[model samples]
Target chain A: MRTLVDGQPGTVVPVDDRAFLYGESLFETVAFRDRQAPLWSRHMARLDLGCRSLGFQPPRPEQLLAECRKVLPESGPAIARITITGGSGGRGYWPAPDAPERRVIQCRDWPGEIDRQRSAGLRLTISKSRLESGPVGEGLKHGNRLVQVMAARECARSGHDEAVLLDQAGSIVEAISSNILLVVDDQLMTHPRPVVSGVGLGWLIDQPGLDLRLRPVAGEDLARCSEVLVINSVSGVRPAIAIEQYRFRPGPTCRHLQSLWNEQLI
Target chain B: MRTLVDGQPGTVVPVDDRAFLYGESLFETVAFRDRQAPLWSRHMARLDLGCRSLGFQPPRPEQLLAECRKVLPESGPAIARITITGGSGGRGYWPAPDAPERRVIQCRDWPGEIDRQRSAGLRLTISKSRLESGPVGEGLKHGNRLVQVMAARECARSGHDEAVLLDQAGSIVEAISSNILLVVDDQLMTHPRPVVSGVGLGWLIDQPGLDLRLRPVAGEDLARCSEVLVINSVSGVRPAIAIEQYRFRPGPTCRHLQSLWNEQLI
Candidate 1:
């Protein structure tokens, strides 16, 4: 993997960086091919909105792209992660108003297993852990992800590819690292809030010939869906074979969505 | 400020450190006077339990203390922070089972404002943010503190010393950085779970001649309490002057607890 911290080639960050101390940061993971990030706009839009909401000065798109290009491969598939953090400061949760934003762009080879899992379908389990509700930065892709880390550990222990997380009210929110999508009555649906809104899902929803609706998926509602899909920027679209007891097979809609997602990566 | 990463004097951490990436870490803040950390044992007990729960190898007490001593002042009050992270690794949330834990010990001057607040009493406000519910590491002092960070920002904006956060069900959990204490009917009451089990509060409860009860505090219960306080290792005890509309004054019980806390600090 290669990294650039604020355009400097380094992997170390100051201990006082608020991201390291209080998870005061926002991040985006984009899948790129031939040094081009197809979802760059979507990722940046989210990052810009997050920076404004969190009170950090948003990075300029031109400079950020230049930094990202420095870390990308010449002509192959890779993953680019852009992290914007409240820069190093004194000991406190309230960020200093004058503190600059620390931008770190990292590039790594796309894991081959994601492709295998995408093709073979994923074995998923519902996690026992629940997420916090309401509009408290839940839709932002921020650094405070201990809940997802624990849920992923649970999936790894259970020999499952992914784990589904629910809110305290038993409403299905998302997967460990992806957005939850349901194909109900031949229409695609997903949770509206209390989740990190996915860049990949947003792109897919914008594409022509797609029928999408935003709705909360209750625990019982999982059984009502014909197919359950997990979507993320790195792994475009993965069909879930089973979530504990409920079983599913990759259907025509799943194939159609995968084709649409694949076409853009090229 | 002075820092020792793995016992080496440094202020930078690798970008891949899980604590920086996924908030996959636990931390403790200790207030030391003349090189003596009064709540070291309690902090270590909490860290050990958190490591076991989250699957990290907990650092031994002796080595941790030695590193902390390297950065402490010889004769004045200072704040020491011990951070244990899932050390540098590949791009993923699930930590490697054999991955080594990273220990970071840092010391800084104790903020004098805490002393003023403890004496003058604190203006508190109820935060709009609600915490996640259930037994998902709510009582642990881990690095996943974005919710607290945002709530602290709210307090700063509203000109309050601290902000009280409730759980999704409107049950009072804790303040941004301290545990909540309610002096109700001549007895001290605090939430049993859904709050960072505080070392300072623990010591106060364990001391002689104090009545304590572990119970949930609903939003409505705020009016019933005659006094409200915030307790933490760094600040000891701070009486709340007000929480939104409900008013409180430093009463006899608050003074008694402060006296007991002060006796040990010396």
Candidate 2:
């Protein structure tokens, strides 16, 4: 893991940084390829949207992009994270009426199974913990993530690759880190929600003959699906082999999202 | 503001630090008296409780005390902050099982008119935003704070000194930063929900004469109060002079809490 602070290489943060104090910040994850972040634009757009939605001004894009260029080695796939915060303050929730301090970070060597899993598939667990629902803050990767953190812990404890999260109202939102898309017969239908549906799922929907379905998907509906794919930037689109005993054979729709993702990124 | 990273005088937080990524952390705000912090023990206890709740193997108590000693050099009240996180190999939210990274930070300053105003009074605006109410991660000053951040922003925009928050069910919680207490004639009262009665508020209640009346304090009920005080660690206690059009002068209860608070800290 490497971090560049205000354009120079460094570590540690301000004591009063509101990100740590209040979780008053926004963050994004991007896929790095050959010394460059492939989905940098998408990640930044989402970050910008989140900051605005929550009322914040992030660091200038060029400054962030330049810093990212310095840290990302000309190499294989890795994860690049950008966090912009309202900076440190006293024991008050009101932000200092000024520009927030920005924190951009990148972590190297994760899983080492990106290509292997893309070729094979992943197994998911239906998490008892639910993703937050409502219009105020759904979808974007804001800093307050107690629910997702719990769900991830649950998946690791249960010996599963990931967990599928339903909203508080019992509607499928997304997996812990990836979006869930089901393939039935030839249709690529995914649970639609008022919450997050970011670039990865949007790209998957754009694939030809994918037959994207946007409706409520309950955990009970998994038994009727022939194939399922969990989507995220790091993992692209991987088929779901089993969701707790119900097995899914990898289908062509899964392969199609993969090929389209490759074409889009590489 | 002066920042020293591991005794070096400057500002730059390491990017790989877990507090930046996972929001896995805790902090303590010790109110400064001439050259030392008042109620340091209570603050330390709350920080420890937060660590215990977050499941972070607590750090050496002496080390944190030493960090505070190293930072304070003057005779003015200030806020001392400490953060501990499990990071490196940074899985974003999924802390690496057993990585312990702690950062202790101290800020030297108090807000404007905090002491003087506590002697006089304050005005509070009831916020429409609701604090996330639950046992999963409630009350601990962990970083899941977008909820409070939004409420704080509205407080600033609305031109109010503080904002009273409620739960999803319209139950009164606390001010954005302080524990709320309303006095009707003689008996003192406040809402006793854990989400609002964080460690700071809990300690404030144990003081004699300032008996805590546990009841649901609604928006309608607040207007009928003869005196109100927004209490917290740093501020101690400040009488509520006005809320919208409703007003109250500093009375016996507010004066008693203020004197008791001064005796305890200043």
TM-score of each: 0.94, 0.86
lDDT of 2 at A46: 82
- Give a tens-digit lDDT track for model 1, residues A132-201: 6533676888898888888887888888889988887788888988888898787788887747888887
Number of the predicted model whose DockQ against the real structure is largest: 1
* CA displacement after TM-score superposition, residue A64 of candidate 2 (Å): 4.1
As a TM-score, model 1 comes out at 0.94
Tell me how far the alpha carbon of residue A208 in candidate 2 is from the true structure, in angstroms, after superposition: 6.1
Please provide, for model 1 over B14-133, each residue's C-alpha lDDT reduced to its tens digit, 9 standing for 90 to 100: 998888887788889988888888889999999999999888888999898888888998888988889998887844777675779899988978897987898889998899988865
Q: Output DockQ, candidate 2.
A: 0.41
lDDT of 2 by residue, A144-181 (tens): 66666667767877888888888666766788778888
CA lDDT, candidate 2, residue A116: 82
Best by lDDT: 1
Off by over 4 Å in 1: A218-225, B218-224
